[model samples]
Target: MRIDLTNIPSEGKSLHFTLTPDWWKSDLDEDRLMGLEAPLSASIKLYPAGKKIAVEGSLSTRLVMRCDRCLEPYGWDLSTDFRIYLSIAPFKGELDVELSEDDLSLDFIDGEFLDPAQIIREQIILSVPMKTLCRKDCKGLCPVCGCNLNMTRCSCSSTYETSLYQNS
Candidate 1:
């Protein structure tokens, strides 16, 4: 959803919306590893701070993620809060400029509108864990037979030797 900058009153604006799984499927990339199990509830408040706009929001939802260890899909609950400051892009011409420490923290908007969907999408992606696991004690798959060890025991022996260099 796009919010017009000019429409925001001096008193500020507050918005509440629900983002659906279908919206995520369409907005996210095709290789997205996770899916939304339920609709996400988001609330955002926008305030004009000097020449910049400040946005504060919170979201909660259930996500369907794949386990890295067992390669199984599992549900996870997610709740997060975020804050960002947006300003109009200062550089219009094609010129290389060095960025400072303060420049790295703020978000730049292109036109006179701000897209909250983009912010939510970025937050959701950043919230995901690097290593996903269905359970801590997952046995994973057997190397020899490619069988899921968590489901059933395999006949493959676990005593496999390893060497840095093999004589060929």
Candidate 2:
């Protein structure tokens, strides 16, 4: 989503974007985000100041996730509110900033325009979970018998303990 600076108010800019499920359904190498869908609506808030803009917004959508226990594919809703700073450059080396946060990285743009789509894609990727599970009590498939204990209910819960030397 590209916001024209002329449309922004002097005080602040507020935009309401209707992001459909198809927006996330792109041909990009979304393998990491495969099966993730964004069939929902979201809003973005813009605060523009001196060739720079601060963005904050929230979005909720269904995304693909793997079951942490059984390693199965599952779809679920993910909600996240992100804040970022964007800048449009009129000339090269025109933007600079001093570090204040413990871990803050700056990305400089040499273009005269700003595209929020790139930032949105980055935020979506960062928002994904490293590990997902259908439930906390999920019992994965048996290692030897190859049976999902959560569904099979076998009495093979006993396994070798590698921490036997820790107590000694």
Per-residue alpha-carbon lDDT of candidate 2 for residues 27-99, written as tens digits (9 for 90 to 100): 3533445555556556677677666677777776787766755666667787788877665545662444332
Any runs in candidate 2 off by more than 4 Å, and if so which? 5-8, 25-33, 89-110, 153-168
What TM-score, over all chains together, does every model reach? 0.77, 0.64
Q: How close is each model in CA RMSD to the real structure?
A: 6.1, 5.5
- Which candidate tops lDDT? 1
Which residue pairs clash within candidate 2? 68-132
TM-score of 2: 0.64
lDDT of 2: 0.58
- What is the Cα-based TM-score of model 1? 0.77
lDDT of 1 by residue, 38-146 (tens): 9999999988777666788999999888787567888889999988766544565221212322333123233566677766776777777877778876666666787
